[model samples]
Target chain A: MTQITSAHRKLRIILWSGAITAAVLTLGLAAFRMGDDPSHKVTYTGEADIRSQFSLTNHEGQSVTEGDYAGRWQLVFFGFTHCPDICPTTLAYMGTVLDELGPKAENVAPLFVTVDPTRDTVEILKEYVAAFHPRLIGLTGSEAQVAEAAEAFKVYYERFEEESAPAGYLMAHAGHIYLMRPDGRFEAVFLEGNQPADALAEEITIRIAKEMRS
Target chain B: MIRTVLIAATLFATPAFADVTVTAPWARASILASRPGAVYLAINADPADTLLAVSTPIAKAAMIHSVETGEDGIARMSALATLPLAAGAVVTMAPGDMHIMLTDLTEKLLEGETFPLDLTFETGGEVTIDVPILGIASKGPVEATQ
Candidate 1:
């Protein structure tokens, strides 16, 4: 009986250690995966790593850069004029948000940067941006310049061919609206589909007030 | 006698026994003549049916398109061949989801103008509806805010 009891205790100890080892391995694997996935990284408000540099032309046939709008908060949105649904919807709500901002909107400058530089020329962008809001400015440039701007904002865009589409192609892009501080730093990012106009307006207002206090 | 004939013609044009009902049809006004257009609407079918095709006189090509956001947070637009509707079910095409894409527009879709859209269904046959052109940023029909 003593021998049997000792054997049982040894088996129990081995089973417990095996279970602990498996648990630790699973946790370590998960941690490694989380660290490697870019989507897992949450971009917090005022993250300094995101740069807001860009050298592009305005809707008006003149050259412009980030420094042109230095003293005003920039509402930067990346999209193309040919985008039928998502881009227009975002811009429309953004216009409403601007209206909701009331007089405080004077400090905000909304910029629409085209991801499809090949199709969205300066003339097209001027008319496209005008349909949404008067204060909204459209920006476009050479392919390399647009790429640099998109890279700075961490915006992803790709053009794919669709046989049945009218333009024979379409652009897949990230629908994130980046809010930049007056000092041209990243302030906040808004998902186009996630927030309503009123809620977005409120959030922007609060952020602006916070910046003012600081 | 003329008024009676006009009433009869109107009734014959829109059959009362139509199984499919389309409402709140509206399209965003195009910024330029060359730009494509998008239309949204809600459909209710008494019996199950499949949407086979869509056509509009204002555009050279009209097709049903769906916008899906992948796990990477990229919005991709793809062409859908058909849309299935369940019996007595209401399918709504909105801004970020399913929509009708009008490409190679023959003319610019100006605000306040109405255009005819022909929707062909598998069981319900073809139904033509007038779609109003709203502002580029309009959510839906003025009366129906959805």
Candidate 2:
């Protein structure tokens, strides 16, 4: 090979450095796009499995089941009636997000399932839910039935006695939104309080639209 | 009723309303003529003071409460004798959170209607405000974020 000049050597080094950097960056981007390699798949607890069923009562006191919302995409949130803070806030957010979806939102039902059936009776749920969105369906059942449904959806709830409390007892439960397929199959989960990279309505609309097309 | 007590107390009035001053109130208002609930209110203050107690004419007892959560995820709300409003601090009485508990309400709080509430402070003095009810009129002992 011809003898390389000092300037040529410097140029070669710079070129090689840039090429290597681009290659490494490309690899990193590809890895990130893979969304957690198989070896590192994230394990989420309390996820509702596919084909599970629960018997409950809707806010209108109508007997219902998981299959009641089969033909359309459904977003389900498990919360309690006594939850004055998080539950209503979540429902409000969910309502707002769904409302943002507009016409496409019609195919996606946002469900508010009560974990505290002891207090959130059919009538209570109707009044509570009516205050929010007209479409929002609040479902509740007996304690045992609610617990079974909660387990299937992977929710955690417990009531602590506050002997000194003058503001009635309080209940604490999980904050998670379950996105179910049109056929009532477990699809994916959107964790609460996550500021998603994309708008929730857009993301869910895309998923629902794609599922509808299929 | 708190109003009755206040009126009765004022009937024995001695002029010293200068020691306490409660102000800067924000909350929901009753916009309707008839409602089945109560309104919420919040306040802010500077210089340490104690919200000794609250009185309201709308209910038999209006207690100052703060939200609390237990280790097992149970949320509870209890009355507070004094909520310290430090210098440049803010106190809120919102839905599903810390609020002025109006028990055994006497009047029907509808949208557009304003009910009176009296809050007595140890240092900042006393303030009477109208808390409008605008939240869901449903039972909520389960969804606690204390």
Rate residue A152 of model 2 by lDDT.
73
Q: Per-residue lDDT of A87-187 in model 2, one digit per residue for the tens? A: 65567667777777888777887788887687778878887777667888998999998888877766677776543222445456656677777877777
What is candidate 2's CA lDDT for residue A106? Answer: 78
**Cα miss at B116, model 1 (Å)?**
0.4
Candidate 2 C-alpha lDDT tens digits along B60-108: 6656667664443334556677777764454545444576554555654
Candidate 1: which pairs clash?
none
Best by lDDT: 1
The candidates' DockQ values read: 0.15, 0.04
Residue-wise C-alpha lDDT for candidate 1, range A71-165, written one tens digit per residue: 88889999998888889988887898898888888989999999999889999998888989999999999999999999998889999999877
Docking quality tier of candidate 1? incorrect
Summing lDDT over every window of 10 consecutive residues in candidate 1 chain B, give the lowest-scoring window. B11-20
Two-chain DockQ for model 2? 0.04
Please name the candidate that would achieve the greatest TM-score relative to the true structure: 1
